[model samples]
Target: MQTVAFTQMKDGTTEEYQFLRSLEHRYIRSLPERLEGALQSLGSGLQGYQISRLEHSLQAATRAEADGADIDYIVAALLHDLGDELAPANHSQFAASILRPYVRAEVTWVVEMHGLFQMRYYAHHYGDNPDGYLAYQDHPWFVACCHFCERWDQAAFDPSYPTKPLAYFMPMLREVFSRTAFDPAILQAP
Candidate 1:
């Protein structure tokens, strides 16, 4: 196992990002809230929002489990879109920055690629050949996600997933909430 230590704050500062260690610490801490925030944000578009992003994340995590991923991967699978709430853009990239602390490279890779893989699945659904999705599944990252999905904590954490009460994400989100990669600093408030 590998671990990185970085200080996590509700709002990040230049000092917080001084080293990879601090960055990693921030990532681990922010994970849960971002998970819930993303779900809530995505689900906001719905009427009753019955099938929330949180639900989707859980389902995706479940799917990852069926596919065979590690706990980290499962957590990644569950919370990959935590950033979709506001940006709906490269939120995973932002998530990567936030999760730098808790997740390993392998787990981070899976989350980073989730949006792309999701697009691949869309393409496959439209005769684009779901192979793209399958190919991702074949990758070690995907395998890790599948294995990770199998774990369920029901409270405190389920492999550090579905982050509850946006507060949790605050700590980790500070690490990766940057507006741009060229400039490594969080632009918005957490």
Candidate 2:
């Protein structure tokens, strides 16, 4: 069917719902391309940094790869700041939600909390509590989030870092996003 017959969700027939589901699955398969476009847009995002947001992201992923992190961590590093443009106020959570259905729980938790953990680097200068992340210190993934910020997210701003280009990460991004959505095996706690 070209379009659903129903104008509202409550009126959708079984066949129409199935058709919509097929369409959605096709759209889902294209996520990596959409994400590539989004990352490209970040080239013009928030200024003042020596590098573009895209560069920061590329650098973060490059560091993750160099450190021998698994695909989930590398992809997480690449996308950790994707919401910086549209959800600057809660970018971390926004990015995490995008990744929640694909990556491990620990990765999602770290990405969700990276913004708070990152405060330790600059919040004190703004009179905000740098120790804000201390509240989660006892959580299982607290150290992982701390390392995410300290080693990748917070440290990826250098203009001179030899970061891999976006093309270099496309395959990895495609691999991760192509995972069966919300697969229990993939999302299970690490």
Candidate 3:
């Protein structure tokens, strides 16, 4: 296992930085497996729902795929709730972080904002304004996010929906997560 010689960033030579970058590159290659483990852990159920969190995620992905959504959309649907275990209040942002590097800005924005859009379904039942989503009614991706919640996330609690297993999505996960950390298409100057 090669390592950087410096203990602090300011002390590093180019050689040490290259070594660290190599290590990071190798580590990133295994991200799909790591994400899968995180998804599997959702089966433990922190707060109960009509279905386990893992099932809800699978159903969402399955729905997205069935609806003829592109691969990025399906993958986003699968990971949209990944942050619930660590940041339930801001899970959409957490999930969006994982997507931002690999996907289109629109896809990332949809993932980032789906939590608020989802609230429209039942927020009023808990005394929160269900129309809170109206705050973003004019944003470009607003309709896409609303459709995501309407067609996939909110409707995914069913236990007998014939949701695909996690293994079925492994290839897509690997392909999506294997991209370079920064996309040249998005980052390069026009």
Candidate 4:
């Protein structure tokens, strides 16, 4: 039970401390410290911290864990965009493949839904036609994530919250890494 308490995030003004808690507490403990470490080293969920998909994933994971979702669901939320931070352009499928070994269909669905969700939201909000939106419904994960996103997005920070540009985020990844797991050491390795 390595309880790590973290300070409030970049978008927040308040100083708060709460231990990182997960729903499948027992399983995570035995999975290897590297799992959490790998997740922690991941930083802002994408290569550039400013992108913020990963930070959002952490927030979403924290929310899901507290809500008592299953382990697969918990990891899915935590790693929903695990590949996003790496290849922002082609990450959805990459993330799914990366996680295939460690998780199950439930989590995989969420990962797959991310693209559909973003596509549909962009089209519905901007484009007049729903040609792209219609395709999203065909993805079962899209439906599940839509419902889940609705619940947690309320607490998600603004995309530009840290008041810094995307380029600056890469440098600040140390800050991102440090806060995620409440340990600065994870930022040491490549």
Candidate 5:
């Protein structure tokens, strides 16, 4: 395919713009594969947990699937910790950003705020407030986020858990990411 020749966006012609957009569409289609690769890499960093980060993530998704979560929710659970390697300080927000355009706002919100919700489980060990999540208690999705963290995220680290392999989720991941981002026809939070 012919490529855009402009060094800057302002100089691009209409044809070039269309070309770039097509390229972007193609690249977006590969998001699921990219996410799977990222999940695989999670095993390389941080070691305090009983299982690898990849394992924890798979277990979380496994549990979510077992609980009959929708594809978007299960995929969200699978990729929720993907940002840990790149943005440990704000991993939840990073993951949420990735999911925001593809999933429901509530799912994105849950992913975004799960880190704080998860703190309720063991934050006291680090001298942090266990009830810090209470700050968001009145939000409509608070209960859902609480369930996500309590039932899936926080409880997914068991070594003996029957976590499905990453390959098991690839098809669902691809389907979730295949959605038209920010589609006006779909319901989403403003």
Candidate 6:
């Protein structure tokens, strides 16, 4: 069928649901391409920085790789700021949600908390509490998040950094997004 017969969920048939599920699976398989497009769009995102948002992401990913991070960490670093254009107020959480289904819980948590941890650098200039991340200091992944912000996210804005191009990370991104979504073992918290 080209489309479902029902407009509402209460009226959907078994066959219709199966067809929709198949369509969804196909769309899911294309997520890596969509994500790459989104990252490319960041080239025109928020201005005023020495480098573009896409460059910042490339720098972060490059730093993570140079640090000997695993595939999950490298991918997470590359995407941590992806939501800046669409969800500027909560970009960290936005990126983390996208990564949650595929990467380990630690990487997801670090991405989620990077925004708060990043405040330690410039929030004081705006008269905001820079130490707000302290609230989560007792959490198991707190230090990880701090390290992520300090080493990858916040430090990636340099114009001179030898950032890798998007093509360099395509295979890693495809591999991560190719994983079965919401696999229990992958989502398990450490």
Ranking by TM-score: 2, 6, 5, 3, 4, 1
Q: Candidate 4 regions off by >4 Å?
A: 1-38, 41-54, 123-133, 136-142, 153-155, 158-190
The CA lDDT of each predicted structure is 0.51, 0.95, 0.90, 0.51, 0.91, 0.94
* Model 6 agreement with the true structure over 89-169: per-residue lDDT tens digits: 999999999999999999999999898899899999999999999999899998888878888888899999999999999
lDDT of 2 at 78: 97
Instruction: Flag clash pairs in model 3.
Output: none
lDDT of 4 by residue, 3-121 (tens): 33444455332232223334344444444444444555566344544435556666666566567776556555665566655666766677666455555555555666566555544
Q: Give residue 43's error in model 6 in angstroms.
A: 0.4
Worst 10 residues of 4 by lDDT: 169-178
Worst 10-residue lDDT window, candidate 1:
149-158
> Which residue runs does candidate 1 get wrong by more than 4 Å?
1-42, 46-50, 66-68, 123-190
Cα-based RMSD of the predictions, in order? Answer: 12.1, 1.0, 2.1, 16.5, 1.3, 1.0
- Which candidate should be chosen as best, given lDDT against the real structure? 2
Range of the 10 consecutive residues with the lowest summed lDDT in candidate 6: 181-190
**TM-scores of all candidate predictions against the true structure:** 0.46, 0.97, 0.93, 0.50, 0.95, 0.97
Off by over 4 Å in 2: none
Residues 1-190 of candidate 5 have per-residue lDDT tens digits of 5777899999989989888889998998998888888999998878998999999999999999999999878999999998999999999999999988888888999999999999988999999899989999999999999999988998998999888999999999988888898765543775
Query: Per-residue alpha-carbon lDDT of model 2 for 2-119, expressed as tens digits?
Result: 9988888999899999999999999999999999999999999999999999999999999999989999999999999999999999999999999999999999999999999999
Tens digits of per-residue lDDT, candidate 3, 164-190, equal 999999899998887776686742422
